[model samples]
Target: MQTEKVIEHIVGWLKDYATNAGVNGFVIGISGGIDSAVTSTLCAKTGLDLLCIEMPIHQAASHVTRAQEHISFLKSNFSNVTDIRVDLTPVFEEFKTEVSLDGNQATVDMALANTRARLRMTTLYYYAGLKGLLVAGTGNKVEDFGVGFYTKYGDGGVDLSPIADLMKSEVYELGQFLNVPNSIMKAAPSDGLFGDSRSDEDQIGASYPELEWAMKVIEEGKTISDFEGRKREVLKIYNRYNNSNKHKMDPIPICEIPSDLK
Candidate 1:
């Protein structure tokens, strides 16, 4: 598919979703990453009131400068861009101390990362309500349909996702197709959490290409006959998300009641 057509499709998807949701514009988290960068650009080009917010923790200094560059790109392209710098160190510290989770560094880092994600989500919803815009999800197909790499109430919460159906590789191609800044396209892809230690592939143990192939096979209804070995591996990751993120994927929870007189 031509990249320009993909961009147009993204715009149309957002337009349709917004119409259904009764919203006019989009609010995106600018994490100095490729996914958010492209989503912001698409929202801007469609003449939407695109608001980009930056919420970075103390651990993720790798993309701090990149965040500013992304804001610059958004400003030049979109007139309704808002750059908000939210430092979440104190909040994360308080959370750790309150929960007595200040012992484990990994847990602390995870908490901090989640704190940033939730804070950014809050900002998005705040302005989304004010401007009558929906919160645009930057997660692509690799993260969305395949593995569910996003956080539950944090990055996973969104009003709509325009590029959620596109694979990560497709997003890269679309970036070049739309002439997004090389800073964004060439920049490394990370969650900007835990001192740049957490990567999409690192946590999933599979690349986007591999995940896409498995997804296509499942989509075609041609199951384990071909790639049974690979299917097993993908199933492991798939099940991990299913087991760990119950609240994120499921319908409203129902409290289990004991069967007393059955």
Candidate 2:
């Protein structure tokens, strides 16, 4: 579908989902990335009461600035858009001091990074509960499912995901169609969990466009033997990330028995 139609459909779906689910509004954590920018714009288009929150825990200044800018844009275009900033640094620091871990520094750093996401998740849901709103998620297809890059119960925990099916490339396209600020649309995507502000590509080892192509190849049941050169490299990277993160994407395993007794 065209970007215009996709935007309209997503808007309509948001409206219908809220109406059916009896939610009064949506609460979304704005990370200053294209996905969040597009998701917030779509939620605003639904005409429901919405809260665009910037929960910064030692977040990058550039990211916070872009988030506030996008929030301002949303407020100007949509009166129902309510914006707020929550600082979770103190909470994170306290938690960090309280917890103890054994392993390499990398492991500890990763755990702390994920803690930031979970802290924001808690903040979003806290407000959502108070306002009777659903927590809207911003993850796109590539990050959410293709490589399972989101932290489970952190960025992955949401009542509704409006764009989990869109590829990262598609998200950029929709952001442009929505007239999102060029700064955010062109900004490197990141989870904002790392204090040093590494781009998602830096963390993932492959860019979104490359990841998207590799996702297609894998989903089609193609083997690495089917390609050579750059294609093989892409497949290798995809498999490395996707295979290790499978636990993040799959549903919880449950023990079940047949009802043959009946």
Candidate 3:
């Protein structure tokens, strides 16, 4: 994949989109993950106002550190880049107090984890609205399309997705080219929603490379009967996520009224 050309294309695309939309620039949540690091860098390269926000809710120390490191790296390299840290721990706690927690422990925990992402999304959009900036998404191909791993109307809600077409491996290639912090490049990929040390692999039960391969084979018209052993297991994991989270991948359902009735 012409990595340099790809980067140039994304940068040019972003700049053109923002200019056409009449927005000053972009505002994105920095999660210290490869996707965010690469996407934010591409935004900065456009020479437009780029706001990197850190919204942490019981976030792991490593995630926080890596996020800050990446923000610092961006600020040093790009004059148009700026950052802010918003600690939402108290806000999250208050929200839990007002909501019903009656459910299966696992289900309740999952809902709250998604809440963290929604809160961060709200924060990003709040600033974007105030500053006339578009909310830039950091999701990649695997998470956004293949597995539907992100929260709907949360991290999935964005004005633009600069890297949604790039696979996870391709995003990493862009990260390396953009000179993202070494700590971020080396850290295990995580959603950081659980506020623990669990990586995305732990939650998905398949590493990105495995999922990427599964996505590729499935796209090529392969089926479960064609593989065995661990290959089958990975395919199963990918299919489960892709099926269950189809709602996130598809457009919201709208009831169409009959023209005669109208």
**Cα error, candidate 1, residue 242 (Å):** 5.5
What overall lDDT, based on C-alpha atoms, would model 3 receive against the true structure?
0.95
| lDDT (C-alpha, whole model) for all candidates | 0.75, 0.91, 0.95
Candidate ranking under TM-score, highest first, comes to 3, 2, 1
Worst 10 residues of 3 by lDDT: 174-183
Question: Candidate 2: what lDDT?
Answer: 0.91
What would the C-alpha RMSD of candidate 3 be, to one decimal place?
Answer: 0.7
Local lDDT at 236 for model 3: 99
Query: Which ten residues in a row are the worst by lDDT in model 2?
Result: 253-262
The regions of model 1 sitting more than 4 angstroms off are 16-24, 102-112, 221-247, 253-262
Encode model 2's per-residue lDDT on 1-262: one tens digit a residue.
5999999999999999999999897999998888899999999999999999989999889998899899999999999999888989999999978889778999998999888999999999999999999999998998888889999999999998999999988988898889999999878888888877699889878889999999998888898999999888888988998899888888888878779954
User: What total of clashing residue pairs does each candidate reach?
Assistant: 0, 0, 0
Stretches of candidate 3 off by over 4 Å are none
- Cα deviation at 175, candidate 2, in Å, is 0.4
Give the per-residue lDDT digits (tens) of candidate 3, residues 4-100: 9999999999999999999999999999899999999999999999999999999899998999999999999999999999999999999999999
Off by over 4 Å in 2: 257-262
Clashes of 1: 0
